[model samples]
Target: QDNAVPKQASGCVSCHSADGNPLVEGVPILSGQRSDYLEAALKAYREGRRTGGPADVMRFYTKELSDEDIKEISEWFAQN
Candidate 1:
């Protein structure tokens, strides 16, 4: 598997580190997560179906992500 970080996740590493260990206090770890769950959560944020806490931030970040981007990002983080 191509384990290089996804280009689409460039902005994500600031809060959620490349290794999936988020440095931010409230950010959740993404490493080793199920790709399907990550994709679903990202889609929920993008579609405004999820809310509360950092949902707004997540929504903003995910707003411009295409389905393919989400898939790639999800897979990237899942494998980390």
Candidate 2:
């Protein structure tokens, strides 16, 4: 919520593609996951309740995102 405009839709879509890097070693797939689960995971990662590898990398990605961003991302995946 740093008052910055949300990143472009293309940015979000690029990495979350079905054929994207979701399963890359330690990366988590948001595609097809429940929204609640996605939110919880985001919260855990952002809060340090989760740790290690891409969890940490993903935590960094989630940390700076606004709650709205999380919700939008979750919804986007659910629809796809």
Candidate 3:
């Protein structure tokens, strides 16, 4: 398996931390999350279907993510 960090994770770790703990207050931990759930959430954000706190931020980030990008990112965080 390729264990190197995913390129897409750079922006995520700024707030969500590489270890899964969020560095910022109100940011949810991404580590140990379910990959399927994460993928769905990311897709929702990309589609502008998810709303609430940080929704705009998430939408911005996720908008350019392809399905494979979402899968890789979600799996990376889930396994961490």
- Residues 1-80, model 3: lDDT tens digits: 33767999788988898885699999899888999999999999999998877998999999989999999999999998
lDDT (CA) for every model shown? 0.90, 0.61, 0.90
Q: Give the alpha carbon lDDT tens digit for every residue of 19-46 in model 2.
A: 3355344455655678788777777877
| Model 2 / residue 30 / CA error / Å | 2.4
- Candidate order, lDDT descending: 1, 3, 2
The TM-score, computed over Cα atoms with residue i paired to residue i, of candidate 2 is 0.67
For model 3, the superposed segments whose C-alpha errors exceed 4 Å read none
Candidate 1 residue lDDT tens string, 3-37: 77778998888899888569899999988889999
TM-score of each: 0.91, 0.67, 0.91
Give the CA lDDT, 0 to 100, for residue 16 in model 1: 92
| Candidate with more favorable, higher lDDT: 2 or 3 | 3
Q: Give the TM-score of candidate 1.
A: 0.91
RMSD of each: 1.6, 6.2, 1.9
lDDT of candidate 2? 0.61
